[model samples]
Target: MKLSNSTVLVTGGSSGLGGATVRALVEAGAKVVIADVNIAAGEALAAELGDAARFVPTDVTDEAAARTAVDAAVTLGGRIDGLINCAGIVVASKAVGRQGPHDLASFTRCIQINLIGSFNMIRLAAAAMQAQDANDAGERGVIINTASVAAYDGQIGQAAYAASKAGVVGMTLPLAREFAKTGIRVLTIAPGLFETPMMDDLPEAAREALGQMTPFPARLGKPQEFAALACHALGNTMLNGETIRLDGAIRLPPK
Candidate 1:
């Protein structure tokens, strides 16, 4: 769908990949709502984007908050055109460790935020989109989900994070098929390591070692690169029901 004049909502839009997506959508002429738990960052970004963007404090794992965010987009912009499910948590844990048992609570939390949260936003957004009049290509709306390369090439300590991301990868095709009749497209992007705030505290050598794993570019992936692919997926009608790997062909080794 053409982003111009459309209303888009991005979950976890307070920072990192979500923030990049919010900026991209706004620059593409879409009115955007930043749905995030970090109210300060979200509001600050919305304010930076001026009138074209607004912040809707949301904990995506909460169904009510998801619904409210979507409704806020419709209420403010008159219609909901797209949704980007970028809210997720990354906890490094092994299925079994030499030190002790796996942290079940942390594992569950990863699944809840990474998988269920995405589902919450998609279902609510699809319902709202189905109610609106269809657009060209019969497109009522499009949904873009953020996954991780760990889903395919999980490192030794990424069991929980990998499972959560793999669940997202698994959901794409089925949800796309289910929403096909309603003109809603679902797609996923599995990204490699990126230089987001999360990685900022890492030692320089550690960060460099991670970047060297990428064969060609030989550097950390940029949030804007991920945002570019997301925008492309939204605009291209033929790109549904698929999980595209944006990891520069790097297969992670067992750490």
Candidate 2:
């Protein structure tokens, strides 16, 4: 789908990877709706982008909130052309450590937000997209999900995080196939270490060390880079049902 004049909904859009995507989509001439729990950041971004963007408070895991976000996008742009799932959390806990078994609640929370939340947005956005007329390419909309390299090369402390991301990767093909008849495409982007808000908790040296681990470019991935890939995926209809790795050939080691 051509981004120019299209309408896209982005979750977790208040900051980090989702924030970059919102800016990029608006720059591409697409109307954007920022769906996030961060009211302050979301509203600020929407204001910064002017009429091209709107902020709708959303909890991706909640059905009503997700639907509201979709409705807001449709209202703002007249039709929803795309949905990007960028809302997620990271939980680093060893299954067996000094604390005994990892907190089950943390594991469940990670799954709820990272996995189930993504699906909530997908289902609602897709339903709205199906109601719209297809473009010349018989495409009504496209959906991009955010997975992680951890899903493939999970570290020792990433059981919850890895499992959640893995679920996202697992859903891509089946969702794409199911949506084929309706002209909506589903895809996932499994990114490696990147400079997102989630990385802020690390010390500067630690973050730098992690970046140097990448085989090439030898630095942390940028949010804009991820956004660029998302834009590309939206434009490339043949790229459906696939999980593309945005990592710089980095196979994470167990830590």
Candidate 3:
């Protein structure tokens, strides 16, 4: 769908890649809803972006909350043209840690937020988008999901993280097929190492070393790069039922 004058709901939009996507969509003339767990940051971003953006506190795992966030976008433009599922959390723990088995709660939480939460938004947004009339190209809306290269190249201590992301990757084709009748496309992006807030917590030396591992440009990806891909994915109609890798030729090593 065209970004100009479109309404898009972006979860986890308070910061990181989601934040960058909100900015990108606004710049491209799209009305954006920042749905996130962080109310303060979400509101701040919405206020900073002026009228083109609005903030709706959302927990993607919660069915009611996810629907409300979608409704917020519909309220802005009477329809949701796009939905970006970026709300997620990550934790690292080995299956057999020194403490014994991995924390089952942590693992479950990761799946809850990253996998099921993503599915939650998909169902609600698809339902909303389906109700709208199709565009000239017979397209109702597009759904963009975020995965990680870790889903494929997961190292040690990434069982929970990897499984959650892998679930996202696994859903792309099936969801796309199911949404085919409604002309709602489903696509996933698997990103590599990046310069998100999570990365900033690492020491400078450590961060540089991590970036150096990339095959070319030898650095962490900028959020804008991700934003660009997301915007492109939104506009491109032929990119359904696939997961695109945004890594710069980096295959992470087992640590």
Candidate 4:
């Protein structure tokens, strides 16, 4: 699918990888909708991207909110061309911990936002895409989901995060098959540790240590690298129903 001049919706577009993807799409001439819980940041980004971009405050966990965001994008741009599911949460805790017990509520919250939230957006966006006319490549839409390296190499304290991301990995193939008939494609990206606001909360030494874990390049992955892959996935029709790991040969060890 050609990205330029297409209507693209990016969840979690207020920060991190999502923000980078949004910027890339906008620069590539795509009309983008920044869907995020951070209203100020989202609106600010939309403004920064100029006329082709709009922001819609969205709580992806809520079905209505997800649907509304997609609807708003379609209504404003006249069609839905692509969706990037970048909204996710990470809860670092052992499934059975020495410090009391694992917080079930926290675990559930991770699943709700990271796993179910992605599904909600994909379902709503796909439905909207299905109603639109297919493009020259016979494509209706493309969906890109964010998973984590934890899904494959879960550290000791990442049970909930791993589970949520694993669920995302599990859904990719099936959803792709389901949407195939409608000319919609589903893909997932499992990312390695990167320098995002989330990682900024860590001390410098800790961040350096994490970066060293990468086998080659031996540094933290860049948000732009993730955005590049996303754009590649969107344009390369053969890439679908697959979860590509963006980790730099880094198989995280149990902490």
TM-score of structure candidate 1: 0.98
In the order shown, the candidates' Cα RMSDs to the true structure are 0.9, 0.6, 0.6, 0.9
lDDT of 4 by residue, 97-175 (tens): 7888899999999999999999999988998999999988889999999999999999998999999999999999999
TM-score of each: 0.98, 0.99, 0.99, 0.98
> What is the per-residue lDDT of model 3 for residues 90-124, given as tens digits with 9 covering 90 to 100?
88999998999999999999999999999999999
lDDT head-to-head 3 vs 4, winner: 3
Which residue pairs clash in candidate 1? Answer: none
Instruction: Give the number of the best model, judged by lDDT.
Output: 2
Q: Tell me the tens digit of each residue's lDDT in model 1 across 77-192.
A: 89999999989888987778887988999999999999999998998999999999889689999999999999999899898899899999999999999999999999999999
CA lDDT, candidate 1, residue 42: 96
Residues 95-212 of candidate 2: C-alpha lDDT, one tens digit per residue: 9999799999999999999999999999999999999999999999999999999999999999999999999999999999999999999999999999999899899999999999
Clashing pairs in 4: none
Off by over 4 Å in 4: none
Off by over 4 Å in 2: none
lDDT of each: 0.93, 0.96, 0.95, 0.92
